[model samples]
Target: MKIPRVVVGMSGGVDSSVSAFLLKKRGFDVIGLHMVNWDAQEEGTSQCPRSKDESDAKSVCDRLKIPFYTVNFVKQYWNDVFLRFLENYKMGRTTVPDIDCNRSIKFDIFHKIAQEKFGADFIATGHYATTSFGDFQQNRNDSQEIRLYSCADPLKDQTFFLCTVSQEQLKRAIFPLGSLQKTEVKRIAEKEGFHAVATKPESMGICFVGKRKRFAEFLDEYIEPKPGKIVLSNGKTVGNHKGVHHFTIGKRINGQYLEERSHLGYFVSRIDAENGDVVACEGSHHPDLYATRFRIQSPDWIPIRNPLEELPDSEILCRIQRTHPPVPCTVEKCETSRFLSVIPRIPLRATAPGQMCVFYTTKNECLGGGEIVEIQDTLV
Candidate 1:
C-alpha cells in the first residue's frame, strides 16, 4: 500500500510546524510548501519578511526530515486579492482581503499546484478550522457533502475567513490544529525543540501592511485622496475628512474640523460616496450605527445545495466579524434571485458593504456566506 503524500503549507509558525510534525508522526509522507504571497520591494522595506519566513519554513522541514519548497504567488495575490482590496477602500467600503486570499490563492491555486506538480494526495494548513470529514480528513466520503465547522478554539475560529471556500476546496483541506488550542500548539512546538516558532508572535490583520507606520498612511501610497464632508443625520456638516477611504462604519472620527461638539465623540454611520459625504452620529451606541436588516449578494453555500431553498424561512445564525459569536438570523429570498435578505434577532453594529455575512447552523457548522451589498434598515 502506498503511503498518502500530504503537502502542508508551512509558514514557519508554531501552528504549521506542529501540523507537519503531527502528519509525519502519523506515518504519512509529508512535504512542506511555503508560499510567497507579497513582495517586500513593493512596500519599500529593507528587510524582506518572506526571506525570514522561507528560511524558517525550510528549517522546520529539515528538522522534520522532510522536503521543502517555496512557491511565489506574488502576482496572483496582487491581481486577485490586493487589487480588489484597494477597489473596496477607494469606494469607501471596508473589506477583508484574507477571505479572498484563502478562496483564490491558498485553496484554489495552491491546490492545483500541489496536485498537478507534486502529486499530493491531500493538502493541509494550520488554519484553526475543521470539517465534517474530520480534521485530518480521516473519514472523508466522496458522496457525502462536506461541511465546515468552527474549530475547538472559538476565540481563534477562522471559519469566517474561510466562508468563501467552495465544497470542492473543503474536500481536500486538512486542518491539523483544529482540535488544539493555541497554548497547546505552542507547547507541542516547544517540546519538539522548535522554540523559534513557538515564541514567534502571531501575525494579525492584513499581511501586506507589514511594519508600516500606520494603516491609513500605507493606504495613502496607493489611493488618491478625495476630500469629503462629515455631516450629521439632519444634514448638518460637522467636520471635514481627507477621504472616505480612511474611515469605516462605526469607527470614531478623529479630526480638528468638527464644528459640532458632544460629550461623546462622533462615529461614522454611513459613507455616501456619490455626494462625498460621510454621515456621522454621536456616541458609539447611537441607533444609526446599528442595523437589524440587510441585503446581501447571493451566498456561496458550502453545502452542495442552498439551505434557504431546502428550508425556506428557517432560523440561522450569522456574524460579520470572525471573533464575534454568531447571532440568530432569519433569511428571506429577495424579489431578485441575485440578493438575499437577512435580519438578525439582535442589531448588528458597523455592518458595512463589502463585509462578508458568514452564516452558521445552530450546531456551529459553517453554512457559508455572502458579501453584504446593502444595509436595508438601521436602528433609527
Candidate 2:
C-alpha cells in the first residue's frame, strides 16, 4: 500500500517550513501548499501578495524536494470572514477575524481542497495544537477519534481558536508543532536548511484578508464618524469624541480637555451609538478587566448534548477573552433565552460584547467558550 500523502499549509513561515520538513523526515509523502486570501490588485498593495507567498513557499518545497500547490480562496474569505467582521464592528462589537479565518477558511476550505483537488490524505498546519486521539475514546466506543491538545508553548498555543472544529475535522487535522516549544521548532527548521526559516516572524493581531490597513482606515471608508459628547459618570462633560465607533469600553482616554477634572484621567464606560454618544467615566483608579464569570455564546458543541449541560446549572466559569486565563464561577441562564448572567469570580472591567469569553477550569480543561454577552454601562 502507498503511504498517504500530506499537504502542509506552508505560508512561507518558519513554523510551516518545519512542518513540511518534519513530515518528510517521517517518511510520509509531504508537500507544501499556500492559500491566497486576498488578491494584491484588490488592495493595490502586495504586502502579502498571493504570487509572492506562493513563490516563497515553492522555493522551500524545491529545497525540501516536495511538490507544491497554490489555491485561490479570496472570494470565500471576503464573504465568509471579512464581511462578518465588518458587520460585527458596525454593531459596536470587537471581532476576532483570526478565529473566523481558522473556522471558515483554514479548517473548512483548506481541508476540503486538500482532500479533493490536491489528493492529500491528510492536511497539516504549523498551528500550535495537537492531534491526540485516546483522549476522546474514554467513552468506550469509537476506535478512531481525534482531540485537540494545548501546545507546549503556552505563549503560542492556538487551541483556543481551534475550539470550533467538528469531531470529524479534528480527526483529519494534524498539528506537528504542538508538542514542541517554539524555540525547538526554530532549531529544527534551521538544522533542516529550509529557506526563510530564521526570519519568519509570527503574524499577530487582526486578519484583514491581507489588507494592509488599520481598522480605523477600513471603518472610516464604510462607516461615518458621528460626533458625540464624552461625558463623565457624574453627567459632567469633558470633551468631544470623533465617533462612538472609534472608542470601546475599558479603554482609558486622556482628559486634558476637562476644565476642572480632579484626576484628569478618564476611561470609556459606554458607547451610545444610537444617540451618537461616547460616555467616559472619570476616576483615579481603573476598572479591572478580569471577571469571575461571564456569559459565552457561539459555543462549539462537544458531541455530548452540550458541555454546559454538565454544569451545576446552565452557568459555568469563564474568561472574557485571550488576555487572561480562565477562572471559576457560575451563571444564571437569562430568564428567557441563551443569555447567561455571569457572577464573576471577582469584579472586573469592560466585558465588551462581540468579544469571546472562553470557559476553562482551575484544572485547565477548556470547557469550550462563547462570545461575551453585552457588558453594562455602569462601572462595578
Candidate 3:
C-alpha cells in the first residue's frame, strides 16, 4: 500500500502555509511547489520580490520536512494572464487577472506539472473554497460529480475567482483552508511555528502592480496615452482624460483637467472605447452607475451542463465581484447561443464589460460563471 502524494502550491502566504501543514498532518505525502509567475527584471527592478517569497516558502517546506521546488511560469503568465488583462484594460474594460491566472496557470499548467512531473495523486492550494467532496475532503467518490462550494467564511470565500475551473481540475483539487476562517488559519500558522507567515499582511489588488502608488501610472507604461473627452450623460463635457483606459466604470473621476463643479463627486458611468469617450454621472449613488441587466458570454458551468438547460427552475444568484454578495438573478436565453441575458433582482453597481459574472445556487454551490459582454440596462 502506498501513501497518496499531494503537491501543495506554497505561496509563502499564511493561508497556503497552513494548508501544507494541515495536509501533512492528515497523512498525505506532501511536497511544496512554488510558482514564479512574474520576473522583476522585466520591469527593471534589481531586487526580485519573488526571491523573498521563494525563501519563505522553502523555509516552511523545510520546517515541515517536505521536498520543495520552484517553477517559473513567467512566460506562460505573461502570455496567458497578463496579456489578456492588458488587452481588457486597453479596451476600457475591467478584468480580473487572478481568475485568468487560476484558469491558465495554477490549475492548468500547475496540475500537469504536479501529476506528470511529480507523479502526485493530487494537487492542493490555499484557496478558501470547497467542493462536493465536503470540507476537509472526508467524503470522496470517483463517480460523484464535483460542485464548488463557498468556504466556511463567507468574507474569505474565493469560489468567485475559481468559477472557471473545470470539473476535471476541481476533481483532484484539495482545499485545506475551506473549513477554516482567516483568523483560525493565522492562529494555526502561529501555533505551528510559522511566525513570519502568520504575521505577514494579506496580499490585495493586482499582483503585477507591486507597491506602485498610482495604478494609472503603471498602466501608462504599457498603454499609449490617447487623450479623450470626459462627458456627462447629458452631453455636458466636464473634463478631459489622458485615455479612456485610465478610467473604470463606477470609479470617481479624478485628474487635473476635470472640473469638480458638482457638490457630489462625478463617477464614471460608461466608457465609449470606440470614440474614446468616458461618460460620468453626478454621484456615487447615481442611477446611471447601477446596472439591472447585462449580457454575458456563454457560462462554463461546473458539471459541464448549462444550468439554464439542466435546472431551469432552480434559483440562481449572480455576483460580479468577489466582495459583492450574490443576488437573485434571472438568466434568459439570448437570440444566439453565444450569449445570455442576466437580470438581477437588485441592481449591481460599477459593472462593466470584461468582468466575470459568477453564478451560485441558494445552497451556496458555485455554478460557474462567464465574462460580462454587455451592460444591457441601467437603473435609470
Candidate 4:
C-alpha cells in the first residue's frame, strides 16, 4: 500500500489540526501549510495572524512529525483580494474577500504549490463540506465534475463558502471534518494529543483585522473614511452616520449608525460615496432588499458536458450569503445555465453586491454560485 501525498492547511485551530491527524491515520502523507497574508504591523500585533496561525500549524505538524512550510502571500492578497474588497466597498457594493481568497489564493495559488512544488496529490482543509461525485462525474462528462455537499452539522456547515471552488480544485480537495461535529473535532484533536488543539479560539471577522474596535480605524490606514450623513430616500437629513466606509446596504435592527429617533429603526437602502450619505427607511415598512430578479454571471459550477440545461423545467434555490437562509426561487433566464436571474417566491432580506449567491438542489447538492455585481433600487 502506497501513501497518497496530501497537504493540510493548518491555521493553528482545532479543525485543521484534526483534519491533518485524520488524513494521516487514513494512510495518506500529510504536509502542513500556513499562509502569511498580512504584515505584523497591519494586525497591530507583535506577529501577524497568519504567522501565529502557521506557528500553531507547525506545532501540529511537529506532533504529527510531518514537514511544515509557510508561504508569504501578503502581496498576492493585497493585489487579488484586499484591493478588490476596498474598491468594491468604495463603489458602494459589498464584497466577500473570502470568496476571492478561495478563487485566487486557497484553490488557485495554494493548489499549484501543493502539486507542482510540494509534489502533493491533494490539499485538505478543515472546512465542513463533503466532496462527492455529481451526476456528471458518474456519466463521465467532457470535464469531470465534483459535487460539494453540506456537512453533518448544519449549525457549523461551511458549504456555502466553498461552493465557489472549481471542479479541478474540488477533485483534489479533502474535507475530513465534514462528517464530524465541531465538538467531535475537538475531541479528536485532544485524543491525538495536539497542544494547539485546546489553546486557540476560533478566528473570525475580516482575516487580519479582528477585535480592532472599529472598521473605520482599519480602513483609515488605507482609504480615508469620508464623513457621511444619514438621510432618508427623499434626501431628508435625519442624522449623521460615522462615515461611508462604515455602512452596507440593508443595515436594519440596530440602526446604531443613524443616531436619530425619526427613523423608527431604519434600514440602509443606499449609500452615496460622492455625497457621503447613507439613505435609510423604516425597517419594517421598507421594501425588501431581496431582489425578485437577480443575475449571476460566469458560474464555476457548470459541467462541461451537461451544459446546465438552459431552459430547465425546474427552478433553483439560492442562499445569497452564508448566514442568509436559502429561499425558493425561479430561474427567469439561463445561458448554458451560466448567467441566471432568480425570482424568489417571497420577499428576501438585505441583498448586497459583491456577495456570493450560492444555489442548491433540494437534495442538498450544490449546483453553483457567483458574485453579486449590482443591485436594483439601491438608491442613495
Model 3: number of backbone collisions: 0
For candidate 3, report its TM-score.
Answer: 0.97
Where does candidate 4 have its weakest 10-residue lDDT segment?
Answer: 133-142
Q: For every model in order, what is the number of clashing pairs?
A: 0, 5, 0, 0
- The 10-residue segment of model 3 with minimum total lDDT is 41-50
Badly placed stretches (over 4 Å) of model 3 are 44-48, 312-314
Reference-based lDDT, each prediction: 0.90, 0.68, 0.90, 0.72
288-353 per-residue lDDT for model 3 (tens digits): 999999999999889767776776534789999999999988999899999999999999999999
How well does candidate 2 match the true structure in TM-score terms? 0.86
Which segments of candidate 1 are over 4 A away from where they belong?
A: 45-48, 311-315
Model 2 lDDT tens row, 90-184: 66677677778888999898999999988887788888866454211222234744445566787887767766677767766667787789889
lDDT of 4 by residue, 1-97 (tens): 7667988887788888888888888778889988777767677732336656777789889989989998888899889989988888776777778
lDDT of 4: 0.72
Evaluate candidate 1 by giving its C-alpha RMSD to the native, one decimal: 1.4
Clashes of 2: 5
Model 4 clash tally, residue pairs: 0
lDDT of 1 by residue, 87-164 (tens): 999888989999999999999999999999888999999999999899888989999999899999988989999998
